[model samples]
Target: MSMVNQTQVHETRLSDAVNRIAPSGIRRFFDLATSMDNVISLGVGEPDYTTPWNVREASIHSLERGLTAYTANAGLIELRRAISTYLTKRFAIDYNPDNEVVVTVGASEGIDLAIRAIVNPGDEVLIVEPCFVSYAPIVSLTGGVPVPVPTEISNDFMVEPEEIVKRITPKTKAIMLSYPNNPTGAVMSRKKMAEVADLVIEHDLTVISDEIYAELSYDDEHVSVPTFPGMWERTILISGFSKSFAMTGWRIGYLCAPEPYASAMLKIHQYAMMCASTMAQYAALEALENGQEMMDEMITSYRQRRNYFVKSLREAGLSCHTPGGAFYAFPSIKETGLTSEEFAEAFLMEERVAVVPGHVFGVGGEGHVRCSYAASMSQLEEVVERLKRFNAARIGR
Candidate 1:
């Protein structure tokens, strides 16, 4: 035997699933942005604003009172009750706090728990791409195969019901959706949502709706998929305080679903996470209770940014559709004779401007780059100039 010692018999390495998960391509640009000085970054998706004062104050108070004990595995009842009321009043969606809700570390966790709860090994979950980077990998981690359906900018990236139905097979178990979508700020209309709801009902498929950006809508009120007829029983609604309350670091979110599903998600959640941060839960409770004015103010700022930034991209000779929701603007760079990754790298390396390459978000994302308007207006203005200059160098503008 060639040095086959007992210690060498066991190899410490990542599992196949972990190794197969595609790394977030946004991070490379982010690392580059961090290492360079005098660079204006519109790469990361975090809001530039600090958490609203009242929300921060509540968490501080919680700390001062030494309220650091572990909450119920489901989370504090008070927070759950607040969320229950908020959803009912705001979206006309009702869920009993006792059996239908579970607070998660973030909408991210809620999504993971919900998937692991429903998807069996080899089960198929339909996802719309250029979507959130985490959606596919998370599904894979649960031993469920992620099936992506392409959605394009020509149609504004709305998930079509026909495309979904064509992809459905006997192995199909659920559809995962995020709208207003990340990377492209597309928000599905209520009528279109109803159509998808009908498809789900027809297939008897479940929908895991990630409404993390629901409060950031610039047009009509955000619609929840579960609110449609007969869809409630099949939809798992996931949202959180991060976007609206500017509480991204708080890691607080919740999921609402009917019995068994909610109960199932909670079981995974309780064992995996124990509970979300107690102080953050209290902070989220405060956000739900008293942060409306602050949330509205932030949404107003994002709306202004969206209008200005999208207009700038169009005027600069790039094709960009004004997003109806969220803070990102995804514009095609194909006309410049460069792929999304090459464009993003050259744009950063030469102009000292950083943005995320679109392909990182999955299908229908290539030939474009995702820019976050969550940065300050000054940074955004500089970004437009740099992007225009970069485009001119590569292709006649």
Candidate 2:
């Protein structure tokens, strides 16, 4: 102060866009669960399984071979070819690895890049909820309006074409979809996906389809929205090795879109990310080549957990729909007469169980909490018992 407050001279102002977004609503429960002993947590969306040995070994071999240098701005052409082949074989979509694919750090980054590259200042992106918490904030960061179109539990929280149709306006530029969805393990059926695809075609809107949980679908075959007739050109298909291969830390994801958008996104990616990690890229290739057996085993386990969790949650007084995919159980906590946040906080503090409040996921998510079964069976069972106790305690039992 005596020196005329020179410290104030370089005070930086953050942009309004950053200021506009709220911190994740799940942070408080997560923080409370941190380092707490005897806490049975279903709060995290991580696969408890480690990455397959073969996949990890490939990365180790790459590092041992000193393949540490950056590959290309769009990533290794060989890796891209693998991705191209994988998508076509798995989801029946075609993309030229040479020009149409860009390896991103994660599907998370691919989502951000897609929106930023195409959305103008005033354009709007319709986000289906309750979704992965990052979608809206990232859209906001790109100066696009984040419009949430809510789905219902009556329909297992699947997004309907009508809900999306009512929200479309002149400013609507794209629609972001994730299925099997996060928070809610709801998958868009092929028929339903086709309906939305038709709507997109009619409106001349782009669709950013995030299929990170593609391999985890349980009851129905996971449909790639881009596979619909006339949908490939307008779909920015995003997927990764994370969920399927238990490769979350590998941070390898990809985008496949038609020209101009692909080229445009690459420009931003080249200047920003340069390329995804070299060793991780190689690991992804290995996952594509040899990890199917491991992925199948993990999916089988997750399906068993899904069956147990849904039945136990309902019997314990929480209403949960049997999720067709992913590993989350989004049960209504409204019967306990507590808000989603209130119930989550109380559950973590009293019963020592952690879960995410659904309200954080966006509109139409209140009155529910998301419990993940991505933990061990013992942990999931114990959490259910704790939630039963929590529900009983609320009623003075």
lDDT of 2 by residue, 212-235 (tens): 999999988899888899988898
Best by TM-score: 1
Which 10 consecutive positions of candidate 2 have the poorest summed lDDT? 3-12
Regions more than 4 Å wrong, model 2 = 1-12, 395-397
Off by over 4 Å in 1: 1-12
lDDT of 1: 0.90
Could you tell me the TM-score of candidate 2?
0.96
